[model samples]
Target: MPKLIVVAGLLLALTACGKESTPTPPPASQTTQAGSGPVDVNVPVEMRPVLSVDPPAQTPAPAAPDVLTGKDGSTYRVGPSIGDFGRFENVGVEQVDGRWVLNIELPDDTAAIFATWTAENVGKQLAIVVDGELVSAPEIASAITGGALQIAGSFTQKEIRELERAITGK
Candidate 1:
């Protein structure tokens, strides 16, 4: 019984020592810095100097009201207000009825707004602005009613995503 107790006590002491010897991680701010020479070990673990890195310089964002070239080589000017109708809540582009369409969600009060905008602007270029940039300007083909309208033009995948992002306000 005495030998067994001594062995158990020795095992417990070893386990406790293992648990206590675990190296503590430094604070969140400190990290291993890269250097050409060998790392110095004399410095205190907590006081070891790390690198001070400045964030990447922010480039000036491009100005708005810029003209963008569409896939069909047509130039489109960024419009001041692309979808200002109160009815059109979320406008998006999609394919419907065998043609690519610009879907606009409309409320009850702005039912006639889409028709009026399309009717007055058919054959005239209107800017499809996304993220404050003129993405594409496709001519209004015809006056459309209801909550959906089709915008037909030569559009690439990038242009489609840009237009979708802009229309969705994402």
Candidate 2:
């Protein structure tokens, strides 16, 4: 089980670490039919270990080709490559304490599996990916046994609804 809810410094990661900084898909990729894409509720994939880069110049030329720099001169770590990926039984956009969140409910069997995985990987991050882009990566501090997960972020109604469609495929 994952730490049921991890709201700690997640926004900081978004603002400082990159990725979830923008709670919406790139304007270019925005669409009216988001149901076509799939959302992978990874612990950002399993809240796996990640290093946000503040690049150094004159680095070794032998660096991995995939290690590319962002427009802001920051490096984007290829995340989202390592955690668990699955479809939730339900996904909804709602307001909790004045903040909008993505509420996800997993299937019964998956809830048990997630509990085990989260227990083993405490302190790691859980990444949520939609269309292969890292949307949210919140750290897991405890195990999550229930199928319900609430991912908190700065979301507009449109972004949250779009995410809902993407995850539900409806």
Those runs of model 2 whose alpha carbons end farther than 4 Å from true positions after fitting are 1-84
Candidate 1 structure quality by residue, lDDT tens digits, 23-105:
22211222222211221222111100111212223443233344443333333334345344322444554443333333344
Candidate 2 Cα RMSD (Å): 9.5
Question: What TM-score would you give candidate 2 relative to the actual structure?
Answer: 0.52
lDDT of 1: 0.34
lDDT of candidate 2 over 53-146, digit per residue (tens): 4564555323452343433444445443443546556565666555555666666766777667666766555544444444444555556667
Best by lDDT: 2
Top TM-score: which candidate number? 2
True-structure Cα RMSD, model 1: 31.7
Q: Candidate 2 at residue 18, lDDT?
A: 36
